[model samples]
Target: MSETENKITFEEFRKVELKVGRILSAENLPGYKKILRIIVDLGGEEREIMSGLAKHYQPEEIVNKNVIVCTNLEPRKFGDQVSDGMILAASNDNGRPILLTVVEDTNPGSQIT
Candidate 1:
């Protein structure tokens, strides 16, 4: 795709509320080997987010880790779980995925501008 087509307008980008979320809990989704259901604390409010990280991470590997989350995405139903947000990650061609994290410790729900 061309850069023009791939680029998003500032107004359109602003619609996504990207924030930091601290993972409170994480577990493998039943019968789903590639997915993990994680509960994240976004400061005061908590949200359940389902992420496909089991291929690269274990449940114990992500708990307490602060990650960037897209808080404005429309809820998605995967299997029996309803995911309310999306965790951001960077995946390389080797298929290794790394969760995006802050350089310094920051408060949960801190807006990423």
Candidate 2:
């Protein structure tokens, strides 16, 4: 198949675990210019996620915000933090990252779509 036809199947897409997680806390990574280390509460469990949103968002601006995340990604270590998931965001033409937020308040770990 051509690359265009090689896209993920519906089953594969369903396997991606997208869930809403509330930002319990956020902080700048020491010595890093564009990474924010955030702790997210996924209802029953809390995990740390590293996002390159520092250039667009501040810690105080993002805290308590309900955002979407891929909960099944493999953990990655950056600096001294091990990120357990990825925060979802949209980018503008200018390449600024705009975080995806829920329309209404939902319990953390609520499935997305």
Candidate 3:
């Protein structure tokens, strides 16, 4: 496979509402092996997202970290919980999922385009 996969039209990409958000709170969702319920402050209000990053970092470590989230993604049911958005991340050296983080001190709900 090529380093880059097949290209997508700009229009197609635009459909994904990639928004910047701040982690306001994080808590382990009971009974899940790798899920954490995260509340993101998206400027106007907060959105809840369930991400599987508990094995890599403590909930406290991710609090206040700005993140890129796909807000338009269809919410999925995890056991009994619904994930409203996707917390973007890349694989770590050990192939563990590491959520993408922001560095420019951008405000929550900032458009990523």
For model 2, residues 1-113, the per-residue Cα lDDT tens digits are 79988899999999999999999999998878999999999999999999999999989999999999999999998987898999999999999998998888999999988
Model 2, stretches more than 4 Å misplaced? Answer: 1-6
Segments in model 1 whose C-alpha atoms lie over 4 Å from true places: none
Q: Which candidate number would show the highest TM-score if scored against the true structure?
A: 1
- Clash count for each candidate, listed in order shown: 0, 0, 0
How many clashing residue pairs are found in candidate 3?
0
Q: Return the TM-score for each candidate structure.
A: 0.96, 0.93, 0.89
The sequence of per-residue lDDT tens digits that candidate 3 reaches over residues 1-113 is 67468778889878988889999999888998688899998889788899988887788989999999989888998878898999999996888887787778998999888
State, as a TM-score between 0 and 1, how close model 2 is to the true structure.
Answer: 0.93
Q: Candidate 1 at residue 20, lDDT?
A: 99
Report the error of model 3 at residue 74, Å: 0.6
Top candidate, metric lDDT: 1
Ranking by TM-score: 1, 2, 3
